[model samples]
Target: MARLAQVTSSRNREVVAGFDNYADAERAVDSLSDKGFPVEHTTISGVGLRLVEDVLGRLTYPKAAGLGAVNGLWIGLLFGVFLALFTTNAVAWFAVILWALLWGAVVGAVAALIWHALSGGRRDFLSASQLIADRYEVLVDPAHAERARELLQTSQS
Candidate 1:
């Protein structure tokens, strides 16, 4: 926790520039780096952060099964690769992997169906959430603030 506090400490830093979006702030930092500024002393802080969730669609049993199947398929493939290493025959190796994948998919689908049924329609939607900020501020240590401002001004001109 001490290390984390040290890393995130902004005690003597001042905002050199502000932007409505992250891209502009990133570009400013890139400019500073290109101009040989001490980029290590700089940090981009997002202001007024909020969580935005976009509902993709309704969650159904079929969609849940499909998602579970894909996840299980990857797990099966990984395990199959490890198990196949023990087999020397080409035919046996292929057969083992194929069987593992099939079993994984069937098991995953059944499990997802059972889980969906148990949910009792309490939560039944698909959505993605993102943390966004109203503005991005580029801050620099007080000691380097003057040089950073000069470089940013020249770059903008």
Candidate 2:
């Protein structure tokens, strides 16, 4: 369980610099930090967001089964180790782990096959999704915005 802290939004923030991408905005903030500016007053925000999905390749039945098996293998190993830790019979540890691994692979393959068949070939490709922005802006508290801009300008020179 991770703890999260929430702070109220400041209304007096001002944008000191804007960049075409996040890397440039990040560098600007880093430069301010290096120049002994109070970087805590700054924030990087993305503008004009877009959702992009890149298709990696086609997903076939064999590929799906292999992916599921790989995932199941790791899970089986974890469960086996946990079970072996509590068991009193030392000699049966290897046997228990091996059994779990074999069953996990078989079950994983069958489950994947069933899921693919149920999908009715709607989505048969692998892809990754990302949210991108057209530009990134570095904002600072109103009081420190001018100093931040000055430090960034000096560093660039």
Candidate 3:
């Protein structure tokens, strides 16, 4: 997996505001843009970050089996359609689709049940992870920093 590079700046850059969230930092830049400040000279940096993992839901036998069946049904439908394209009889096309659907559902259900059993209930939940920054800083070119800061401060007041 690819990771984001750390943000750095030279002495020529100045900090506008240290925000606790990205939205606040983005709003500061938007204010600068509204005031006709050259918004191109700005960048938002996320600092002091940590990865957060959140559990979404539990994976159970019924849920897994249903998911697998749905996926298989779509695949089977596509395969049937592809096969039908090579033939001219309408009756044969329906027959292929029905056969594919029946077999696909049975195969999918059995496969999911076996896979779930193999897990031994070790990991049975869905989770998502994201990198959360403790703070966000809006930086601008030194030449425009003073004006940007002034505009942001006035807007907040």
lDDT of each: 0.90, 0.83, 0.83
> Each model's TM-score, in the order given?
0.87, 0.77, 0.57
Q: After superposition, how far is residue 54 of candidate 2 from its true place, in Å?
A: 1.7
Q: What is the clash tally of candidate 2?
A: 0
lDDT of 2: 0.83
Best by lDDT: 1
Error of 2 at 150 (Å): 1.5
| Model 3: colliding residue pairs | none
Evaluation by TM-score, superior candidate among 1 and 2: 1
lDDT of 1 by residue, 13-64 (tens): 8899999999999999999999899898998999999999999998899998
* Clash pairs (backbone) in predicted model 2: none
| C-alpha positional error of residue 27 in candidate 1 after TM-score superposition, expressed in Å | 1.3
Query: Tens digits of per-residue lDDT for model 3 on 70-141?
Result: 778887888878887876788988988887887777778778878888999988987899999999998888
Error of 2 at 153 (Å): 1.4
